[model samples]
Target: MTTAPTRFAPSGPLTGTVSVPGDKSISHRSLMLSALAVGESRITGLLEGEDVLATAAAMRAMGADILRGDDGVWTVHGVGVGGLMQPGQALDMGNSGTSTRLLMGLVASHAITCTFTGDASLSHRPMGRVIEPLSAMGADVSASPGGRLPLMVRGLAPAVPLEYRLPVASAQVKSAVLLAGLNIPGVTRVIEPVATRDHSERMLKGFGADISVETDADGARIISITGEAELKPQTIAVPGDPSSAAFPIVAALIVPGSDVTLTGIGMNPTRAGLIGVLRDMGGDIETLDEREVGGEPVADLRVRHSALSGIDVPPDIAPSMIDEFPVLFVAAAFAKGTTRTSGLDELRVKESDRIAVMAAGLAEIGAQVEEAEDGLTIIGTSGDMLPGSAHPIASSLDHRIAMSFAVAGLHCRDGASVDDMHPVQTSFPTFEPMLRGLAEA
Candidate 1:
C-alpha cells in the first residue's frame, strides 16, 4: 500500500500559459483501437499517465507490437479484428474504469478467457453495467458479490449483436458495448437517453469502422456499427484534457487578479460543459484560436478572475460534463447565491461517490451544501473564507476528487488538505507540478 500524501497551498494568484496532458479518454481509445487496427498506427500527444500506460501494456501483452519513439510518438502494430491472443497473466487495470471496462469489451468478442483485477478502490467499483450488456452479446462474465471487480470474462467468437438502450449516461458503458460489437457478426446498436462524450464513436470512425449516429424524436441518439469491419492504421493526435484543465481554471477564477491561458484543450461539445457552466456564472473566459485537431475541436482558453453569480445548472447537461462535477462544485462555492446541479446520479458510481464526498468536504470547509438523491446544491460564499476547523478531506483514492478539493483550498480561508493523492497518477501525474507552477507565476 502506498502511504505518502501531499498538500497544496496557494498563497496568491495564478498566472501563466500552460498545457495539460493529453485527453485521458481519447488516449485510452487511441491505444486500444490502434492495437486492433491492421498495420502500424502512430499516435502523438498520447497521455503517458498510469491509466493509459496500463492500457498500452495490456495491449502489448495481448500480442500488439507497441513502442514509444524518442520524439514522444506511440506506434502500435495491431493483430487485426478477432486476432487478439489470450494474455498469459491477469490484467491489472489499476484505478482506471475506462481501461477495465473497455478492455472487457475487447476480450468478450474473442475466443479466450481473461481474469482482471485492480487496486482496492477500483475493485469496489460497479462492473455490472458493462457486464450486463456484454452478457447479452453471448459473453460469460463472473464477478464478486454486488458485481464488484476481480472478475473473469470468457469471450465468444462470432458473438451475437445487441441493440442496447442505456439506463445511464456513461461513455465507458457505451464504449464497452461498441468494442464488443467489433467482433460480432451484424450491426450492434446503442441508444443513449442523453448524449455522453462521443470520443468512442469519433475514435472508432477515425479507425475506419462502419459507424453512424442518428438522433431520435425524443432527443436520444441511435448509434449503429457494423461488426467485424477491418480497422486500418491511422495517425492520431490526442488533445489536452479539459477535465484536468478545470482545476487550474477554477483556481484562476477564484484567486484575485489571476489570468491564465490553457493551450490546445479538447473542445468536444460533449465535454465542454464546464466552460458552459462557468460562462453561465459570468466568468471571465475567452476562447482563442479555435481550431480542429485530430477530428476534435481544440482551443486556447483565456481565464481571468471575475466576480461570479450562481445559476441553476440543468440536469440535461450532466452527460456533457460528468467527470467535472467535483471541480464545478468548487467554482460554485465562490459564486454568489446557490448553484444546484441535478441529473447527476452518474456521480454516485464513479471512482467514489462524488456527490456524497464533495458535499461532505465542502461542508467541512464551512460552505453551505445540501446533498440530493441525484445531485447536490451548493450555496456560494462569494469569496467568503471557508472555515477549515474541520479535518482534512480523505480523497478515497479518487484522482478527480483529490485534485478538485485541492484547487478549492486556494480560495478557502484555511486552505484545505487531502489525505491521498496517489490516485492522481492514474490520470494526471503532472497535476501537482503544473498547479505549483501556476501558483508561482
Candidate 2:
C-alpha cells in the first residue's frame, strides 16, 4: 500500500550501535531447505520483512508446517524431498524475485503444478533466465508474454538431469537449476562462468545434499548435485544482512561527524564487495572482531565520517555487490573527484530500472551524474551538501532506491523526500526507525 511521502532531513551526527535485519538470501533458503528436510528445523535471526515472509508463506502452502514462536524462533516441519503437494491456489510472491525464481525451481521437479504471481513491480521483471534451464529439465512452462510473471510450471516427476551453463551471473537462476536437481534421478550440473553468491551451495551441503563445486581449467565453476537425496534438518542462525547495512554505513560516512557501529553483519566474500569499494574510496570503515557465524564469516563494522575520494569501480566485482549500487551511487555523490562504474547491466532489470531511477533521482538533488547503458559516471560534490530535491523523489516501488536516497538526504541542504516509503517494508522494515534512533543518538 502506498503511504504519504517521507521527508528525511539533515541531522546531527549519527552515533550508535545497531544490527540490521537477517540475510534475506539466506533466510529464504533456510526456510526452503528446511522444509525439504526429514525432520523439524529451527531458525533464528530470520528476516521478518515482507519479502522473506512471502517465502515462508509459499513454503507453508506447499505442505510444509511452519510456525513462529513468541520468542522469534521459527520452526519448520518438512515434507521431505520430492514431497511437495500442489497448492490450492496461485502462489503470491509479493514483490520478491528471489522467492519467485527459487520456488519455481522447487516446483519444477515435483509432481505438481503451480502458478506464480506477484505485485505489479515484480510482474514487470523477466523470469526467462530461470525458465530456460528449468525447461531443459523437462518442466513445462506457460509464462506471460516476454516471459514475465503470472506464469505456470508443471513439474515432471523423474525429471531429466541437465548440464547447463549460466548465460548470466545470477545466483537465483543458478539456484533454480540446482534446486530442481534435488529430486531428479541423476546429477544436475551448472557451470557458472562468473560466480555469484554461494549461499545455495553452502546450505545444500549443510542439508546433506551431494553437492560439489570445482573450478575448471578455464576458471568456470562446475557445481554438481545428485538427485533423490535425503535432506537432514539442522539449526540455522542467520546473520545480519550486509545489503540492509549499506544504507546506515553510507550515512555514517557522508554525514560529517557521524560515527556508527553495525553489529554482526554477514561478511560473505560474495556479498562484501561494497566494503572493499568504499575503503578504496577513502571511507573510514573498520572491521572489528572477525569471526564465523553459521558457517559464514561476519564482523562488526565501525564507520566514521571521513573525506571520501572517488575511484573507478572494477566491473568484475559487480556480481558480489549488485544489490548495493544504488547506495554506492549516493556515496559517490558526496565524494571528491569522479567515480566511474560500468558492467552493471543487471541494475537495469532490478525492481526499478535502478540505473535510470538513481541517475534521475541523484540529478534532481543537484549531483553531477552521467548515465550510461551499463553504468554511471558520478562527479562528486567534494563533500559539500547537495541542494535537496524540491519535490519528492520518485522511489519507483524499490526498497533499496528509497533507502539510498533517504541517506542522501542526511547531507542535503534542504533535506530529501521520497514519494513512497512503503517499499522499504519489503526488505528493511525497520530502516526508518533505525535511522531515527541513530539521528537521536
Candidate 3:
C-alpha cells in the first residue's frame, strides 16, 4: 500500500450530512467474539478499514469462515470455542494495536500457536501489557525485546484462571485477559483501577458469554467471566465510531459558518467524553435520535460553527476520550483560552506519542504550545487564527494525528500539510474524501 501526501487548506463553511465508519473497537470485538461462537454471526456496520480487515483476515487464517456481502453485511462461521487452528504463517496486524492485543488473548486459551507481526508503528508499540497478564493465565507468550511485536502466543488448553489487577487503564489489556478466560476451566477476573472502553464486556454478553461486571467501593470495575462457556452467535449492528466522528465535529466547530450533521454515532458513555468536553467548551453540538443499536447506545449529532473556550480537561475523563485528544487539541488551537490537560501518560505510548507529536504539530503551525510529562498546554489563536505551518506536520504514522491536523488545516489562514495521509485508512478509509466533501471548493 502506498501512503500519499495530502494537504488541507483554510476553507469556507463546511455543510453536509455524513456518517463515519462503524466503530473500530466494536468491529474488532464483534469479529473476535463471533469467530469463537458455535455458529455463524452476522454483523452490519462493521468498519471495513484496513485494521478491521486485518482482523477479518486473521480470523479466516485461524479456521473461521468469514465473508462480506454486497450490501456490506459480514458473516462469520466459527471453529467454536477452543477450536482455533494454528496458522501457517505469522499474523500481520498491519497498524492495529487493538487487533494484535485482543487476538493474542483469544489465541492464548485455545489449542493453537500463532505468531504475530505488524507494521513498523505497531511493532514499536508495547505488547508487554497484554503479555504480562496472559502469561499469568498460563499462556506461553514471547515477544521481541521491550515486548514489542513480532511475537508468539502458545495457547494453554484448559488455561489457568487468575485474578489480575490492571497496572493502567487499558481496554485492550483488560479485554485480552477476559477473552483468554473463555477457554479456561474456571473463573477469570480483571480488576481495573480506572475504567476504559467496555465494548468487549458488552459484546461478550450479547454473544451469550457468562460474564458480569461489579464495581468496587472505590469506583473501580471488577469484570469476571466464567471459563469453558459456550458462546452463542449474535446479530451485531456495530455503531458509527465516536472517535471517527470527532474529526468532523471539531472541524465544524472551528470552521466559520460551518454546519454539519453526523449520524449513527455511538453514544457509549465511556467513549463520548470528547463530545461532552467540546460542548462544555461552548461548541454547538446537539445529540439527536438517541436510541440503542445492537445493544450499544447511538445517536445522530448536529454541529454548527461556534465560538469555543478552552478549559482544564479533567483527568478522570481520559479513558473515555483518549483517542480524540489529538483532534481536541486542534479545536483548542482555534479557541479563545488556554487548554490544559494532565494525567495522560498513556498518550505517550500510543501508535505515536500523541501529546508530544500533537504539541509539535501545533507548534509547527504557529500555535502556542507547552509540553509536559503527562499533558499539554495549548494557547489558542483567540479566534485570530493560525498562520499555518511552513513545514509539514510529521504524523508519525498515526491515523488520528493525520486526520486531526486535517481538521486543523480547515481553520488555519494558509491551511496545513501532513507528511502522509495514507494512515487514515487504518480506521477511516474514506476520511479524506468525506472531509473534503464538507469543505468549500
Q: Considering every candidate listed, which one attains the maximal lDDT?
A: 2
**Residue 369 of model 3, lDDT score:** 93
* TM-score on alpha carbons, each prediction: 0.98, 0.99, 0.98
TM-score-best of 1 and 3: 3
Q: lDDT for every model? A: 0.91, 0.96, 0.92
**Which 10-residue span in candidate 3 carries the lowest summed lDDT?**
2-11
lDDT of 3 by residue, 276-310 (tens): 99999999998899999988999999999999999
Candidate 3 lDDT at 18 equals: 96
Worst 10 residues of 2 by lDDT: 1-10
| Highest TM-score scorer | 2
For residues 47-73, write the lDDT of model 1, one tens digit per residue: 999999989989988999999999999
Model 1 regions more than 4 Å off: 2-4
lDDT head-to-head 1 vs 2, winner: 2
RMSD of each: 1.2, 0.7, 1.1
lDDT of 3: 0.92
Query: Which residue segments of model 3 deviate by more than 4 Å?
Result: 1-4
TM-score of 3: 0.98
lDDT of 3 at 30: 92
Model 2 misplaced regions, further than 4 Å:
none
